[model samples]
Target: MSLSDDGGYGGDGHRGPETGQTRTRLPGGDGDLYGSGRRPRAGMSSRNLVTIVGVIVLLLAAIAFANRDGSGNSESGGDSPKDTGPGAARPTAPTGTKPVTGKNGQIASGFAKTEQGAQSAAANYAVALVSANILKPGERHAIVQQVFAPAKVDDMQSRLDAAYSTAFLKKLGLDAKGDAAPGMTYVSRTVPVGTKLVKLQGDTADLEVWCTGLFGTAGAKSTTPVTSDWFTMRLQLKWAGGDWKVDGFSQQDGPAPVNGDDKTSGADQIAKAVEQYGGFTYAR
Candidate 1:
């Protein structure tokens, strides 16, 4: 009947020879039914692993490059002078009456957006706040009034006056006005360690001035010995009067370290030294 006569078994329309199932087999060397399956050869798997490793290596390299360039980090902007911490000496102001920037090209304006600017302002302001000027009643009032915000000025001034009253001066062997005894040397020097910007926004900067100061008398026979004190001064600063101005600032003692024993100088010598050496306008 044509080729259809032998369709009973394997003659024409039969199942597979081995499994006896009707299925489609691709033309290959007895592989899987769908296609040749060589179990994803070892070479191909290794190549894929190598590709992944290469991508990871590239990512690591890019990270290293970014770090080396100092672009992706916080302190690497090329615009300002190097930050040398708080021990760095700031430039002295011309009048010796105000604060100044520490390094050249450092912007100390309160209006500055850079970190250096904020730091510089805080350091200088701290120096001004803790100067010997605060011992004088009139000057102290002026400083508090000028430095603090309008709302807080009177309260701060009264509190400061009480804090530096005749009793306080007596404790330091000074008169009511906080002047050093005539024969004894009164040492009150505030040296900034470094400044940190806690927060900075347009027209305002919140800063902390980490400072170490020498207070009391430095003379060998002095009733009050010279001592070192550490304090942090917080400042809410504003750009006003053509420079960085302190809107509200307050000081509290310590975070100080243990005392170190050092030889003491004579009172006259200490007094003379205090008279000779002047203060600085600190910058960051």
Candidate 2:
């Protein structure tokens, strides 16, 4: 019953000396033992000095060239070069390939039995778990059934019901049924920023989804004005009945970025946008 945030969530370098001065012996024979009478040695020969300098210059040039940004010459033009190195950031844009084409009720289902499918399932389940739709008893039950394994649905439903109880709803200025007062819109939406596979094997995957969410009430007189929050959702999913389903999940505070000072929108404007806009079935 862990929901994403939105309130409901749950050394040193050595230096070399100069090459050059000629050593001269001191009159005292002690010079050989102590080497205290050494005189200035002749400076390095012009040819040797030039060669050494040339080698140094080449080394510097080579270093500069090696360190130059390789991104500028990318064949992709100005597009960021594809990073094939280990630990590279994932591409932000969709691959244009849908993660899953099947649906169980309104929930995306039948994800491929692959790592990508596991990620896709985790992301979509995260969205459903934190969505405003889950506020309603009917939709919550449907979400619980569709996103969790058959064995977990009943227990999950009871747990979620308690988590979203009348007291919790009241705190956010919502009725026992989880409805906002007239003229107010309750907001609870999760937008996954990215997903990472922590561990994947056989039929189980441990994933972490970084997300930003909007929650609270939107209305001129609303006490709980809609606001944004950042959080990470850790989902443990298992392949079941030919699809991936949430076996368990938990929420944690962010990996959040600093908030920007953007102009605030009016309640009506926020409500209008939410109504007009549609959410996506996220894919990895």
Candidate 3:
């Protein structure tokens, strides 16, 4: 990731002129996604230059705006969970011993055909999906099998492995699996900022999880220090295999707020804290 906002996907599998991972597609512009697009013009008139600059500025603004939590309907605002209908009991949690429930009385159901339960199933599954544990091989595999749709399990697992490969880790100064380096703390945490039900019909709810996560290392000489980001993870949950399982999901960058001026911690302290603190079972 680059440090500035000029970044773009150069079509060479490398991040260009920007800092973030995902690149933006200009509105109404044709893309060679398969490698075809307009060739760059070397020079242009003042009017055209100004227009181009305006477009770039607008593009960035659009990206930022689209990503803003402007709706103000976020659960973090303390809105009460709504009931879908009368006499419907709250969704159940996975039973280690008892069932779990979500914001409303609705069952946290998944696809009846998938491996997990529904909404609650999807929420819980997402927790594990973005956890620090996935840095480990065995743990990552287990998480994939448990959270993903059975039909896509193998493909997802392989893709994830490739995405989190050694080169990727090195780029972040992390070890092969996502571990923080010695004397430094590597942070890759996904906090559930809120959960919203976009649509809920029998056995399926298109749930959107608003999340904020910190990714980077804490320490002197650290190039990629910890920084926070906001993204919405949309999950297509289905009831399958006796519980709610995720059939598909996708991530889009921020409706994020401006960066806050919080005090930074020492590298060692951050590392220790990560080791000491455990994650929570996020509820709305």
Candidate 4:
């Protein structure tokens, strides 16, 4: 989404990321079995019909049992069984490899030359880019410099400055400097749910990150109370200066699921939670 004057819903009007669609087939009628001009024999009793159905059911069950261990269950053809699970596989345990051992300013840097490293870099950069610090001119510039390729940093910084201008801050109930008013807590946090490497070449990679973010102000008097959002960011990364850096990126509304029925927290509680929790440096 763009960082324009309309809070965080600045781009397209979609509520969340695009979700997969489900298809369903209704049961066909038995009219085809008995022709329009034909009917079951008058001699046929209800008991006979029941028996016929039982036989058909048994025959189908036997066929299914016979094919239980057939090609449908094999992993070599069609879609792999693992790929047809409820959603993406559960994240594996850490491989004991550190995400990144180096930092550029406050952002993670020095990623390894591997797919995992690319994912890690994308995740961390997603978090940093959506952070409240990105609204401040100085911190925004620093973050752009650290997370982006050196060649693109200046251009990105200029674009971002315009995107997060004073008018945009005012629309979000913040001041000219992007600070929340007194007794209000401004929130802009991103949590990466998962990362998928869409394409990987020798020195470039495209990664999509599913993320949930909290943004807006928190306080009883706040016009824009804190709220959550779901989206996927597609990041085009390049191996530059010996580390994975963002070359460009785009965002789309989500693969968001239905919201739960839990009670909403009060302004004070939300504000306290945001203060008590710290963000993580994510890895794939």
Candidate 5:
């Protein structure tokens, strides 16, 4: 996210990108993999060729044997644990813990002192940070104060106010108050796909939140039709007065997938769906 809106492969040879060590083919550091560019004997003997082939055959047989699966008749009768590879990612699932029944004017509050709570806080904070309500100066101030730490409220409010000015809102077909025109719905909603806790210690925690959202206007005569965006937010949270509050925020464009070929709903249908289906609290 150029501080705005936008930021993988398996362990196979084909990858999007890679990090850490690479297989060094240089001659000096690791051993030379190409046998120091030595030429083969011009008059190679048949015995040597046969011996090399035999070694290769044995090596291939050993590899095949090592990769074979069990026959399923062993006494233990259990399969081996899977190695998910170096690029395996953690799966998201419900922790089965209920969220606290608390709210600070639609924003969540009173999170527990746990990693799950930090994740939940990160998700909600990201949602509020990008909502259409941020277009309104007063609402934006309130949101910043509620989701951020007390020490950061003033700076955050000022920064957001500058980003969502009167002119910016106008460009998006919104008024000074961030409201759509009559019979129109200005859509902005962030739905977090998953959250990963990066670090947690004492009164501070860091998290990564992957999200998708709908943004634009919903009306038959609207210029900006609702479109979806995918992004990842990195949040630094601090435990304050028995709750997790946002301390730092940054975003980047997605690990997005190819768009699907789905039927586009009418503006009226889209508006009605948004109104009827309320957003979730996102406890993980």
Candidate 6:
């Protein structure tokens, strides 16, 4: 199943056991020849046939009555089973809060101080951190400064800079400025599938954001062809500057699904699609 299709209705059907008949000997008079190992009377078979038909009908009715899911039982003025009712569950309900308004370059900022805000911050931060824009020196510094807590900024910047060094960019077919060669498109985008508020305390929150993304370069001549990956980013957030900020973060490979059977697109088609689509500012 795709990430987009979580918690859907299955309408699983339950099958009742097959119906059958059991023969039993009833109290009989001396004329009961069948059980006596004698030839049965001619007219007696007719009465036995009638009895079998009645038993089959009654058994079917009992089976049908036992298998009801009880949805319509209340309408008949009967008490439904306590475990079964029309009550619903909203396990994944929306927070009813809107997306953050403020922006720091392409990254969202000024998130609310609530749990929803922390989750929203984590999700948007995932997008910004995994984005193609982060490869560029200017954008990388700006993102680190605006999205991370004050104490984390310097460390994160140094680490990211080293990770995306000149040699790394060259290997990935990008220039020193993190730009793709002409006729090629470097694609890096993270689409958040969902978010979880793992814990929340007075001034801190721990959250996880599940995401799937496109990464690498897309072009026929490009050595690094863009591919998709799944990963979950865990964010340690703290309330700061009247908003939630990332104190630190870590990522794990995935809860990935098996690859699907969709037809693969050409390099030109992938490049065109990336250009046509825009990124999102996510919320819980």
User: Which has the greatest TM-score?
Assistant: 4
Off by over 4 Å in 1: 1-114, 219-221, 250-261
TM-score, every prediction: 0.55, 0.68, 0.59, 0.70, 0.68, 0.66
Ranking by TM-score: 4, 2, 5, 6, 3, 1
Q: Give the per-residue lDDT of model 4 (tens digit) for 1-284.
A: 21211122222111121221111011125311111232222444454344333322332232222223221111111332334342244564778888798777778788887878988898998888767887677788888888878777766676567655676556556677768889888777788899877667788777777887765566765544454567777677889988998876655567777654344556677789999988776776
lDDT of 5 by residue, 172-208 (tens): 5678887889988877778888887766778977677
Clashes of each: 3, 8, 38, 5, 6, 0
lDDT, each prediction = 0.47, 0.59, 0.46, 0.59, 0.57, 0.56
Lowest lDDT 10-residue stretch of candidate 6 = 8-17
TM-score of 4: 0.70
Q: Once model 2 is optimally superposed onto the true structure by TM-score, how far is the C-alpha of residue 192 displaced, in angstroms? A: 0.6
Kindly list the per-residue Cα lDDT of model 1 for residues 59-128, writing each as its tens digit. Answer: 2232222123221122212333335642343553443332442322222333344556667677765665
Q: Tens digits of per-residue lDDT for model 2 on 138-250?
A: 88888888988777777667755755566655645678876889988877677889887766778877777887766555665654445566666777787898899887665
Q: Model 2: which residue pairs collide?
A: 21-40, 21-41, 21-42, 22-40, 22-41, 22-42, 23-41, 24-39
lDDT by residue for model 6 over 1-284, one digit each (tens)? 01110111000010001121111122145322112122222333555444434432332232233222211111212232232322111145676666586887777887887766777898988787667776688888998898878876776677557555776556556789989999888777778888876667788776667777765456655433444666666667788888888765555556667655344456677789999988877876
Give the higher-lDDT candidate: 4 or 6: 4
For model 2, the superposed segments whose C-alpha errors exceed 4 Å read 1-8, 11-88, 92-97
Q: Compared to the true structure, candidate 3 yields what TM-score?
A: 0.59
